[model samples]
Target: MVQVHIARSGVQLGKYPEADIPVLIGAGTVRRTDHYWKKGMAYWLVIGRTYDPPAAAPPLPAASAKPVPKPMRPLRYECLRCGHKANTVREEKPGNFLMEICTWLANPFVGGLYTITREAGKKALCVNCGSEHMTEEVW
Candidate 1:
């Protein structure tokens, strides 16, 4: 059976697999969440238990496909002075990168009941120039 079963108190996680006869009933503690349960040879009455990882299928061909292609370069720009590279950031159709990220960051809270707060991803920055704009990741 699955180790992580929801319980009444905090949660009643199982220590042994469903295949074995359960004697001890303990809370679903993080340490007991193993894939398999082992029996103890040393302790007869108080024997042992363990967890085993679930079986997974072998990797399929498509699961190993190449990464999506990117452009030779993007709108990412950088500077030569600070070397703090970053991606161009903006919100709405803001005037600059700062405006973009700011908009994205606040959009969630500002959207109110109907709107959602999406993650405003950070663009790559030019470490050499301290610019908060990234071109693409060079091969």
Candidate 2:
């Protein structure tokens, strides 16, 4: 039922329940560099030095073991020009520098939105040969 006080960058944030400190740390709300103090402490200590995480519990044995399923193979493509095999294709999109600069000068938010929308439309190309001509290979 102990409460812990937290401070960051020489500023005291607030006090929280001792049990919740681990959850806060796991969620990245509390940093290792932050200082913490609790009752019966002579001085504040760094959270990383003072904190001791709870041990993990042993896993329970299953009554019956099950067979593991095999993973599905990924689709592969072969470049017609270079005969190169690849599991993935690369995307290509031309950027308009003048429009981007103009929009950015007019409004940064609008420019970002316009860039995202413009970049969304792209053409898939071969990874090795950078060609649109490719044939799917079945194994």
**Top lDDT prediction, candidate number:** 2
What's model 1's lDDT at 124? 42
What does candidate 2 score in Cα RMSD to the true structure?
25.7
Best by TM-score: 2
Model 2 worst lDDT run, 10 consecutive residues: 49-58
> What C-alpha lDDT, on a 0 to 100 scale, does residue 110 get in candidate 2?
92
In model 1, which range of ten residues has the least summed lDDT? 43-52
What is candidate 1's CA lDDT for residue 99?
A: 52
Estimated TM-score for each candidate: 0.16, 0.41
Per-residue lDDT of candidate 2, residues 1-28 (tens digit): 9999999988999998999888787778
lDDT of 1 by residue, 41-117 (tens): 33212222432233467777676678888865543444444543345433232145555456658784544322332
TM-score of 1: 0.16
lDDT of 2 at 42: 98
